[model samples]
Every structure is written in C-alpha cells, then in structure tokens.
Target chain A: MRGAVMHAPGDVRVEDRPMPTIVEPTDAIIRIAATCVCGSDLWPYRGLEPVAAPQPMGHEYVGVVTEIGEAVREIRVGDFVVGSFFSSDNTCEICLAGYQTHCVHRGPGAASGGQAQYTRVPLADGTLVATPGQPDADLVPSLLAASDVLGTGWFAAVAAEVGPGKTVAVVGDGAVGLLGVLAAKQLGAERIIAMSRHADRQALAREFGATDIVTERGDEGVARIKELTGGLGAHSVIEAVGTQESMMQAIRATRPGGHVGYVGVSHDVSLPGLELFFSGVHLHGGPAPVRRFLPDLIDRIWRREIDPGKVFDLVLPLEEAAAAYRAMDERRAIKVLLTV
Target chain B: MRGAVMHAPGDVRVEDRPMPTIVEPTDAIIRIAATCVCGSDLWPYRGLEPVAAPQPMGHEYVGVVTEIGEAVREIRVGDFVVGSFFSSDNTCEICLAGYQTHCVHRGPGAASGGQAQYTRVPLADGTLVATPGQPDADLVPSLLAASDVLGTGWFAAVAAEVGPGKTVAVVGDGAVGLLGVLAAKQLGAERIIAMSRHADRQALAREFGATDIVTERGDEGVARIKELTGGLGAHSVIEAVGTQESMMQAIRATRPGGHVGYVGVSHDVSLPGLELFFSGVHLHGGPAPVRRFLPDLIDRIWRREIDPGKVFDLVLPLEEAAAAYRAMDERRAIKVLLTV
Candidate 1:
C-alpha cells in the first residue's frame, strides 16, 4: 500500500507502506475510496508544527469497509462509510453526550490520522456512519466533505446557534468557513456575513448564502460587522480561523449574549480572560465532534439540500499528493480531493 | 450624600459626595437601602486596576426609587428596586436578545456606581426590576444579593446549563460562587461540587446545596472533580473565580461538550487558544447581565425560596463603610453589607 507521509516541512512524499489491519476487536479496515488534504495539514507542512518523523497526512475520507474485527457489529465488509477524524466508542458517556471527538476511551481521534490507502478505524460502530446505500460517484466528494469540513462547519453553525431571524458572521474563507456560510443559511440565518478578501472565495461565499461581505480584518472587520448588525454585532459568529486576531474578531463581532462557534484548528492564540469575560459572549469550539453531525449531513447531501463539495476546487490523483499539499499551502485551492 | 470612595490602593474612606440627580431622560435617582463591597472592588483596591482618583467604590445595591425622569416608565417613585451594575435599556435589540449589559443606547453601565446614598440609575425603565411591593426589613439583604451576586450566580448556572441529572462543579467559594451552589440546586442539578479550602466557605457551600466539597486547588481539584464524575468531568461547571488557574480548572473539570459559565470579574487570566479549542468545552462569561435575572431573583428572595444573602457574614452602618471594606479585604468576611 502507498500513503502520503511528511519527512519534514514542505516535504510530502507518497511512499509504499505496509497495509493496515484490524488490530483491535472493534476496529475496521477501510479501503480508501477517497481522501483529501485538510486545512489543518498545512500546520505541519508550513513548519509551524514540527514533524518529528514521517507522519500520515490526512484525516478526511469516504471509503468502503474491506474488513471488520469480531466486535464490530454495525459496520461490516462491503459497506460504504464516512468516518470522522477521531474514532469514538459511541456508547461512552462522552460520546453519548454528542462530543465523540473527546471520547474518553480513545482520547482525541486526530492522532490516528486518516490520510492513507488502508485506514484502521477504531470503535468502528461508533466512529463510522454508513450512507443509505452506495453513493454515486458525484456524491463521493460531498460525503467526504461530511467526513470533516461540512460536518465541522455544520457544528460551528449549530454551536453558534444560527437560525431564523438571526444575523451570522463568519471569520475565515477556507473550505470550513465557506461551508459555514452554507450551514448558517441551511440553519435559517436571516443575514449571513462572510469576512473574506479573495475575489473567488468571496463569490463562492455569496453563492453559498453570504448576504454581506467584509474585506477588512481584525478590529476593522469587527467594526464593519457591528455596523451591519446595527452597532450591536451579529447574533451569531462562526470563527473558522483560529488565529488570535480571528478569534478576537469573532468574539467582537458577536453581540453580547450572542454565540461564537469556533471550528478552526487553533495555533498560538491566547485569549485575555478579562476581555472574554467582559465580552458577554458564549464560546464553544474544539476538534468538532463531526460524528455527531455526520448522519444528518449525509442525509442532507444525499437529498441535494446542500452542495458543500464545491469547496474542493482542485482534485489530484493520490500519487500527486505532494501537489495537493502545495495547492492548499499556497492558497491555490480551498480544498483538494485526491482520487485514490 | 455619603459614599465609599477609593482614593487609591489600600485607601478607602467614607466621604461626602455630591448627591446624584437625574442626568438622562431615562434616569432615576435611588436612595440606597443597602450597598455592599464586592470581590471586584478588591481589584482596584489591590491595584490590579488603576484608580486615578477617589472613585466611588460599589456597584451592588438594593434601593428605593426616590425620583424618576420623564422617560422613566416601569419604575416609579417609592418603588423598591434592585438593579444591575450596568443599566441597560432592555427594549433594545441587544437587551431583548438578553444581553442588556451591552445595550447600545446605554453602553456598559459600570459608570454608574451604586455605592452612594443617592445614585442615579441610567435607563431606569430597563435596568431596575422592582419588587412586587415594599418588602419587610428581613428580606433586604437577600434583595441586595439579587442586585448582583445572586443574579450573577444564577446567570452562571443558566450559562452552564445546570439542570436535572447534571453534575455541577463550582470553582469559587466567594459570595457569587456560594450562591452558584444554591442556583445549581434550584435549577435541579443532581450533584454540586464546591471546590474550596476555606472551612467556613466550604460549610456555607454545603449548606447552600453543594453535594460534595473538594478542598483541592488547581490540577488536583480538577482531578477530584474527574474522580467524582467517573473520570469524565462534570456536565456543567460554574467558574466563579476568574484567575487563570480557576479558569483552567473550570475548563479541565468540564466533560467534552459540557458548559462553563464564568461570572467572576476576570483578572490577569490568559487562556491558551489551542487548549481551549481542543477542550471541547463551551465557555461563556462576563460581568453577568444581572438585570436579566433581577426580576426572578428578586421574586425568589421576596418569597423566601432561597436565601443568598447568607453570603454576607458582616454588616455595618453606612458611616462605617471603611470597616466593611476592610473586613472583606482582610478575609474576615465573605461579604459585607453597609446599611444606609
């Protein structure tokens, strides 16, 4: 089997590796049908996060289950499935509470890594949600989107409490942020504000349901959001960028008592306790519990109620994985899908 | 009118100040019946916040409406009222959305100090929630509690979503934290964990409905909370202390997808964005919008349903406001009431 591995920053290579096997009773081996380079992958690729050894490069995938361990009951061989970045035992108290990302039994699931030809999905019954049937080729990207970005965006919108009669502001133009616009709209937000400077991304944002666009950043962007929200800030704010400035912008752009659902993978950002305390905003975000939303997202995608797959503007063969990483790192692609 | 003023750090004096009068069309002048030194007042007294001049030193009070401006409608002269630290025009979009603390028309209401014998309440119609009628003397302390501490504690519980079948951990043992225990119980929390070292405060917490008391602090406290919750943190955590350690403890003690409602006046606390983002905890706090809960709190106090005023361990005549501040500063009292 061959899989993407990073020896060092900006040094992605597709190397032959031993095939994965079900090592645990609850594990399932999935033959990768589709996978993609995630925005978070850039953290290590750009040398922001040190890669001590060659590491698996992706965590979003839609695949067909090839084998299952004895304990795996719900998932079986020859079934199409979408799994979250983290594997969770759905029966755990935490998973039952809808936060499968922090499943106590497995810790955070991201450490497992999902960018490979044959991936072992632990807690298969809980971590993987199967589609109603074999999805069409056109539905693959959207289902893959549900594996992370779309579900994450949906969680961000839900966490922000976006709904009818509310104005929502999104901070970031990445695939997740773009999908957040779609989520907010689908969730019934009356007004959607997308903060983006790129012409192409901004156009996609509008098409996805952003009623307003602010090109400014930081305090200026917050001010613009406030102006649009009648000086009170938006009713809901989606923080899809995890930088300090973006977090602060999301917090500042939300009205007092409003919700700020942040889904960005955070980096060196530190929030001032006093400022956050005084802001009077509800804050919730982390490795999104994508498993919690996968079922609904898959259903929505199947019904054509949403088209989040449009976020993947570039697609490459799995052998060209290095190019896919470069496209995302250089901002050439919002998201890149790799055909396995 | 006499008021407690902070001339500088460690220097508090009871001095004659100009009587407050209606300044805004919506303002009302209140003859304070009771005022108290708050934990936040110690911030400036200890020089955590700068005190440039002799600043009026209190923001919590229960008073009798003595006069009302032309625009004041809901509150009438002679009405006994309890108001939040910040006056808000509750009809504004922000206020209607339950964020009166950020009402655009009135701005942050901290500028109107409630310590003076006669204090002018801006946005009288929105800020002051009157009791059903003039209450007996015995209920004054409880009503005063509702003016800030109790309301804040209630807000914390609400923000944390404390309710039936939930385990609630309170991070502070101060007046507000102690009241949080009561709030959690009233909201139907099955188990309330009060983290405190002070024996007196601990006893009070238990009396107020803490099902368990952990004397540990910092990481040890978090461990105890996890141990109590079967290795998963509590479902709801009330952060009544705003220090970094307390905030971190609150965060660490919450289960993934749990809620942390912090109402303590945040001081030198810095939250690492990545840790908070990965924790999967919902964080919401601020100077609590006490006005939003004032009516219900006052009603509960009037009906003798809950006794939050027990947090005030010492009482003094208004002329001895200096001693009241000293007692609270010296840790001899959890809270001090100054009777006018």
Candidate 2:
C-alpha cells in the first residue's frame, strides 16, 4: 500500500507503506475510494504545528469496506461508507448526547491515516454511515464531504442555532465556511453573509446561497456586519477561522443573545473573558461531532439536494498528494480530492 | 435626599445629595423603601474596581413610586415596584428577544443611585414591574432580592438550561449563587451540587434544595463535581464568581454538550481558546438580563414560594450605609439591607 507522509514542514511524500489491518474486534478495513487534504492538515504542513515524525497525512475519507471483524454487525464488507475524522463507540454518554467527537471511547486512528489505498475504521458500526445504495460517480465528492467538511459545516450552523428568520454571517471563506453558507441556507436562514475577499470564493459563496458578501476583516468586518444588521449584528455568526482576530470579530459581529459557532481549530487564541461576557452571545464549537450528522448529510447528498462537492476545485491522484498539499497551503484550492 | 457615596475604595459615607426628579419623558421618581449591597459593589469597595470620584453607590431597589412623567404608562404613583439594575424600553427588538439588559435604549440612571431616599427611574414602564398590590412588610426583603440577586440567579439557571434529569453545579455561594440553587431546584434538576467552603453558605445552599455540597475550590471542586456525576461533569454549571479560577472551574465542570451559564461580573479573566474548545461545552452568560426575569421572580416572592431574601443577613437604616458596606466587605454578612 502507498500513503502520504510528512517528514517535516512543507515536505509530503507518497511512498509504499504497510497496509492497515483491523486492530480491534470492532474495527473494519476499508479500501479508500476517495480522500482529501483538510484545512487542519495545513497547520502542521505550514510549520505552525510541530511535525513529530513521518506522520500519516489525512483524516477524511469515503471508502468501500473490504473486511470487518466479527464484532462489527451494522457495517458489512462491500458497502460503500462515509466516516468522520474521529471514531466513536456511539453509545457512550457523550456520543448519546450528540457530541460524538468527545465520546468516551473515541479513537482517532480509525479514521486517520486515510490518504492511502487502505485504512482501518474502529467502532465501525458507530462511525460509518452507508448510502442508500451505491452512489453515482458525480455524487462521490459530496458523499466524501459528508465524511467531514459538509457535516462539520452543518454542525457549525446547528451550533450557532441557525434557523428560520436568522441573519447568518460566516467569518471564513474556506471549504467549511463556504459549506456553512449552504448549511445556513438549508436551515432556512433569512440572509447569509459571506466574508471573503477573493473573487472566486465570493462567487462560490453566492452560488451557495449567500445574500451578501463583505471583504473587510477585523474590526471593520464587525462594524460592517453591524451596519448590515441594523446596528445589532447578525443573529448567528459562524467562525471557521480560529485566529484571535477572527474569533473576536465573530463574537463582536453577533447581537446580544445571538450565537457564535466556531469550528476552526484554535492556535494561540486567547479569548478575553470580559469581552466575551459583555458580548452576551452563546459560544459553542469544537472538533465538530461530524459522525452525528453523517447519516443525514449522506442522505441529502444521495438525494442530490445539495452540491457540496463543488468545493473540490482541484483533484489529483493519491501519489500526487504533495501537489495537493501545496495547492491547499498556497490557497490555490478551496479543497483538493485525492483519488486512490 | 441622603445617598451613600464612595469617595474612594473603602470610603463609603452617607451624604446629602440632590433629590432625584424625572429627567426623561418615561421617567418616574421612587421613594426608596429598600436597597442593598451587592457582590458587584464589593469589587469597588475592595479596590478591585476603580472609584474615580464620589460615585452614588447602588443599582438595586424596591420602592413606592412617587411621581411619573407624562410618558410613563405601566407604573403609577403609589405603586410598589421592583426594578432591575438597567432600565430598558421593553418594546425594542433586543428587549423582545429577552435581553433587556442590552436594549438599544438602555439607561442606567433609572436603576442606579438607588441607595438613596429618592431616585429617578427611566423607561419606567419597561424597567419597573409593579407587584399585584402593596405587600406586607415581611415580603419587602424578598421583593428586593428579586430586583437583582434572585433575577440574576434565575437568568443563570435558564441560560444553563437546568431542567429535569440534569445535574447542576453552582460555582458561587453568594446571594446570587445561593438563589441559583433555588432556581435550579425550581427548574426541576434531579441533583443540584452547591460548591462552597463556608458553612453558613453551605447551609443556605442545602435549604435552597442543594442535593450535595462540595467544600472544594478550583481543580478539587471540579473533580468533586465530576466524581459525583460518574466522572462526566455536570450537565449544567452556573458561574456566579467572576475570577479566573471560578470561570475555568465552571467551564471544566460541565460535560461535553452541556451548558455553562455564567452571570458573574467578569474581571481580569482570560480564557485560553484551545482549552475551552476542547471542553466542548456551550458557554452562555454575562451581566444577566435581570429585567427579563423580574416579573416571574417577584410573583414567586409574592406567593411566598421562595425566600431568597434570607441572603440579606444584616439590616441597617439608610444613615448607617457605611457600616453596611463594612460588614459586606469583611465577609461578616452575605448581604446588607439599608432602609430609608
């Protein structure tokens, strides 16, 4: 088997590696059909996060189950499935409460190291959601998106309490943020505002149901949002950028008693309690419990109700993972699909 | 009129001040029947908050309306009323959303300078909620509690979504925190854990329906709460202490997907974004919109269903405001009531 590995920052190589096998009685082996480079992957690739060793490079995938341990009952071999970035037993108290990402028995190994020919999925019965039937080739990217990005964006919208009569402002233009606009629309938001400076991203945002676009960043961005919302700020703000400036802007761009749903992984961000307190907005987000939304997302994609696959503007073979990483790091692609 | 003024930290004195009169078309003048020292007041008294000049020192009150401007509608002269710390025009969009404290036309003058013989209240119809009728003398303290402490506590419980089958942890033992225990109980929480070290407060907590009391602080307090909840933390945690330790404790004590309702007046607190993100709890709070809960709280107090006024352990005449401040400063009294 061949998989992408990072030896250091800015260096990704696809080389022959040992194939993954079911390590737990609940695990299953999947032949990777599709995978992608995620925004989180850039954290280490850009040297912002440490590269400890030659580490496996992906945590998003849609694949066909090749083998399953005896304990895996719900997921059987030959079924095409989508799995989240974190594997969970799905019966733990936390997962039952809809926070599968923090499930007591959550293990990242199952869904990670997936940019390869084969990968292991732990807690298979709980983590993988099969489509109604084999999905068409055109629907592959969207289903793969349900594995992480689309579900994550949907979670961010839900966390923000985006619903009918809400004015939603998205704080990032990445794939997740673009999908957030789609989620807000699907959730019946009255207005969707995309904060993006790039012409291409703005067009995609508009295509995804954005009613307005603001290119400003920082305090100016907050002020613009307030201006658009009659000086009260948006009813819901999705923060997909985890920088200090973006977080503060998201908080400030929400009206009192509004909600700020942040999904971007935090870096050196420190939130001033005084500001957050006075803002009077509900704050909720983390590693989104994508597993919780996978089934519904897959259904939507299978039904062709949403086209989240549009986020994949670039696609490359698995062996060209290095180019995929560079394209993402340089902002040349919103998301890149890697075909195995 | 005589009012309590703080010339500097710890320098509270009863002094002659101009009698308050209606200054806005919606203003009403009230003869102060009762006022009290709040935990927030202790911030300035303890030199934690700056006292730039001789500032009039109170924001809570229950009194008889003496006069009303032409625009005042709901409140009438001779009506006994309970008002929150901030006056808001209840019809505004923000107020209608149940965040009166952040109402667009909010004015502090209507509620502040209340530790005096007479004070003017702005937005009278919105800020002051009249009791069903004039109440007996015994109910005055409880009514006063509804003006701020009880209402704030109620807001915290509501924000934390304290409801049936949930485990609630209260992080402060002051008047508001004690009232929060009562609120949680009234909200149908199956188990209420009151975190406190003071025996007197612990007793009050138990009386307010605390199912368990943890005499631990910081990490130990969080650990005790988790241990009580099968190591998953509480479903709802109310933070009524503004310090960094109390804030972090409240966040860390809530389970993933749980809620943390913090109503403390935040001071010098910085939250590391990464830790808060990983905690995966819903954070909602700030200076509670007490006005939103004033009516219900006053009704409960009127029916004698609750006795939040027990927190006022000391009472004194208006002229002895200095001594009242001292008792609260030294922790000799949980709260102090001043009568005019």
Candidate 3:
C-alpha cells in the first residue's frame, strides 16, 4: 500500500508502505477512499514545528471498512464510514459528557495518521460513524470534510455560542474558518464578519454567508469589528488561527461577556493573565471533539444542507502528494483533496 | 473627613482628608459605616504591585448615603447601601446582558476608594444597592463583606457552574475562597474540595461546608485532586489566587469539559497558549460583575439564607486602619473589618 510520509520539513513523499492490520480487539482497518492535506499539516511542513523523524502526514479521511476485529460490533467490512482525527471509547465519563477528544480510556488517535491506503482505527465501534448507506462518489468529499475541518468549524461556532441576533467575527481564512462562516449562518447568527485579506477566500466567505469582510490585521481588524458592532465588539468571535496576534485580535474583537471559541492549534501564543482577566470574555477551545458532532454533520451533509467540500480547490492524485503539500504551503490552495 | 492612605508599600496611615462632594450629576457621597481590607490590597502592600504615590486604598464598604446628586434616582440620602468596587451604570447593553462590571458607559470604578469617612460613588443610580433598612451593629460586618469579597466569591462559584451532582474545587483559602465554599454549598454542589495549608482557614472552610480538604501544592496538589476525583478532576474549579502556579493548578484541577471561574486580581500570571488550548476547559474571570449578582445576594443575606460575612475574623476601629493592613499582610487575619 502507498502512503504519505514526511521525511523532513517541506519533504512530503508518497511511498510504498505495509498495509495496516487490526492489532487490538477493538481495532478495524479501513481502505481509504479519500483523504486531504489539512491547514495543520502545513505547520510541520513550513518548519513552524520540528519534524524530527519521518512521520505519517494526515488525519482526515472517508473510507470503507476493509476488516474489523471480533470486538467491533457496530462497524463491519464493506461499510462506508467517517471517523474523527481523535479516537475514543465513547463509553467513558468524559466521552459521555460530549468531550470525546479527551476520552480518558484512550489517548489521542491522531497519532495514528490517516493519510494512507489502509489505516487501522482503534476503538472502532466507538470512533467510526457509518453513513446511512454507501455514499455516492460526489458525497465522498463532503463526508471527508466532516472527518475534521467541517466538524471542527461547527464546534468552533457552537463553542462561540453563535445564535439568533448575535454578531459573529471569524479571525482566520483557512478552510476551518471558512466553514465556520457556514456554521455561524446555519446557527442563525445575525451578522458574520470574516477577517481575510485574500481576494479568493473573501469571495468564498461572502458566498458562505459572511455579512462583512475586514482586510486588516490585529488592532485594525479588532477596531473594524468594533466599528461594525457599534463600538461594543462582536457578540462572539471565532479564532481559527492560533497565533499570538490572532488570539489577541479575537479577544479584542469580542465584546465583554462575549464568547471566543478558538479552534486553531495554538503555536507560540502566551496570554498575559492581566489582559485576559480584564477582557471579561469567556475563553473555551481546543482540539475539536469532532466525534461528538460527526453523526449530525454526516446527516446534514447527506441531506445536502451544506457544501463545505468546496474548500478543496485543488485535487491531486495520491502519487502527487508532494505537490499537494506544496500547494497548501505556498497558499496556492485553500485545501487540497488527494484521490486514492 | 478621615481616610486610609498608603504612604508606601508597607506604610498605611489614617489621616484627615477633604470630604468628597458630588462631582457628576449621578454621583453620591456615602458616609461609610464599615469597610474592610481585601486580599487584593496585600498585592501592593507586599510590594508585588507598585504603589506609585500616596494613594487612597480601599474598595469594599457598607455605608450610609450622605448626599445624592440631582440626577440620582434609585438611591436616597440616609439609605444604608452596599456597592461594588467597580461602579457601573447598569443600564448599557453590556449591563443588560449581565456584565455590569464592563458597562459601556464606565470602566472599572476602583479609583473611588471606599476606605474613608465619606467617599463619592460615581453612577450612584446603578452602582449602589440599598438594603431593606438600617441594620443593627452586628450585621455591619456581613453587609460590608457583600461589598466585594463575598460578592466576588459568589460570582466565581456561579461562573464555575457549581450545582447539584457536581464536584467543586477551590484553589485559594483567603476570605474570597472561603466564601466560595459557602457559595458552592448554597448552589447545591454535592462535594466541595477546599485546598488550604492554614489550619484556621481549613477550619473555616470546613465550617462553610467543605466536603473534602487537601493541603498540597503544585503537581502534588493536582495528584491529590485527581486521586480524590477518580482521576477525572473536578467538575468546577474556583481560582482565588492570581499566580501562575494557582492558575495552572485551577486549570489542571478541572475536567476537560469543566469550568474554571477565577476571581483573583491577576498579577504576573502568563498562560501558555498551547497548554490552555489542549486543556479543553472553559475559562472566565476578572473583577467580577458583582452588580449583576448584587440583588440576589443581598436578598439572600437579608433573608439570612447565607452568612458570608463570617469570613471577617478581625474587627478594628477606624483609627486602627494601619494595624488592619498589617494583620492581613502577615496572614494573622483572613479578613479585617474596620468600623467607622
């Protein structure tokens, strides 16, 4: 089987690798039908994070179950499924509380990368959510989106408490942020502000229900949000870029007592306690518990209520995995879908 | 009029000062019946925070309304009132949304300084909440507690979402943390863990309905909390100490989906973004919007449902203001009440 591996920063390669096998009683092997390069992948590729060893490259996928362990009762071979980046037992107290990403019985499942021909998923019965039936080819991309970005964006919107009569401001223009606009609209936010400078992304944001666009950064962007919100800042701010500047901007853009739902994997960000203390904003975020929202999101995608797959503007064959990484690294694509 | 003045970090004096007069149309001059030394004031007295000049120092008071400006409508002269450290207009959009501390019309009102014979209160109509009538001398200490520490602790408990069937952990054992225990019990929390090393404070916590007590710090403390909670951490955590260690402990003590409501006046605390991001906890704090809870807290105090004023262990006459500050600084008193 072939899989994507990173030998070092900026060196993603498609190479022959052994096919994954069910090693545990609750494990299952899935034949990947679709996977994609994510915004987070660029972190190591761009050398923002150290790539000390050759590593598996991706964590988002939609696939068909090729084999299932004896203990996996809910999932079986030949079933199409979507799984979250993080696997969970789904029976633990934490999982029962709707925070499956932090399941105490199991560790983060993303360490077992999904960018491969055949990937083994641990705790299969609890992690994988099957579609109603075999999804058609056109539905594959959307289902793949639900594996991470779309569900993550939805979680960000929900954490931000976006709802009727609320004005929401998004602080990033990546695929997750773009989908956040869609989620905010779905949640009935009265106004949506997308902070982006790229023309192409701005257009997509507008199409996805962004009521306004701010092309500034940091203080200027926060000021613009305040101006648009009648000097009180937006009622909710979605932070999809996890940088010091973006986090500060998100905090400043939200009105006091508002919510800041930050979904970006934070890097080099340190918040001064005094500043955050005086901000008077509710701060809640982390790795999205995508498994918690997978069922509903898959249903929404199947009904064609949303089209979040549009974020993948570039598609490449799995053999061209290096080129896919480059496209995302150079900002030439919002997201890249790789065909298996 | 006589007032408490901080000549330097460790020097406090009671001296004659010009009496305050109404400066704004909504301002009121209150003749303080009682005031108290707060834990936050120890920040500067211990030289953790600098005192630039000889500053009037105090923000907690129960007093009689001596005079009211022409525009003051809600409060009248001779009314026994309890007001927060931060005066809010209580009618702005932020106030209407229940964050009166961040009222759009006014910022933090700590500059008014309540440690005086007569102090001017800005936004009188919104900032001051009067009791049913003048109370006996014995209730003065309790009413004064409602002015800040007790209100702050109550807000912390509320923010942490303490309720039936939940486990709550308190990180500080000062007057505020002690009062937080009382608040959690009043909120019907099933179990309350009070972390304290002081025997007196521990005894007070037990009296205030603490179900468990842990005298540990740092990783050891976190380990004890995990051990007591079956390794999942508490459902709610109240942070009453504004330090990196206490903040991190509060964050670590809460479960992934739990809440940390911090009311400590943050000093030099800096939170690592990645740690906070991965923690998956809800974080909110600051100078509590005490005005939002004033009505309910006052009603409870009036009906004798809660006795938060018991936190004050040392009482002194107004002339002994210097001794009051020293007693709190040396940890000889959990809280100091000064009668005017």
Candidate 1 residue spans exceeding 4 A from truth: A107-113, B107-113
User: Candidate 2 chain B: minimum summed lDDT over ten consecutive residues — where?
Assistant: B106-115
Q: Candidate 1, after superposition: displacement of residue B147 in Å?
A: 0.6
By lDDT, the candidates rank as 2, 3, 1
lDDT of 3 at A278: 90
Q: What interface RMSD, in Å and to 1 decimal, does model 3 have? A: 0.6
* Candidate no. 1 TM-score: 0.97
lDDT of 1 at A19: 84
lDDT tens string, model 2, A80-165? 99998999999999999999999998888344498999999999988898888777999999998888889889999999999999
- Compose the digit string of candidate 3's lDDT tens values, residues B1-340: 8999998899999998887888889998898999989898888888888899998989998889989999999999999998888888989999999888899876435345678887888998889899999886777777888888888999999889899999999999999999999999999999999999999999999999999999998889999999999999999999999999999999999999899999987888999999999999999888888888888888888888778888989989888999999999989999999988
The CAPRI class of candidate 3 is high
* DockQ, structure candidate 3: 0.90
Clashing pairs in 3: none
TM-score of each: 0.97, 0.99, 0.98
Share of reference contacts found in each model: 0.97, 0.86, 0.91
lDDT of 1: 0.89
Give candidate 3's error at residue B124 in angstroms.
0.9
- Superior candidate under lDDT, 1 versus 3: 3
lDDT per residue for candidate 1 within B14-120, as digits (tens), equals: 88888887777888888999999999888888888999887877888888989889988789999998888887888887788787777777543434466778788
| TM-scores of chain B, in order | 0.97, 0.99, 0.98
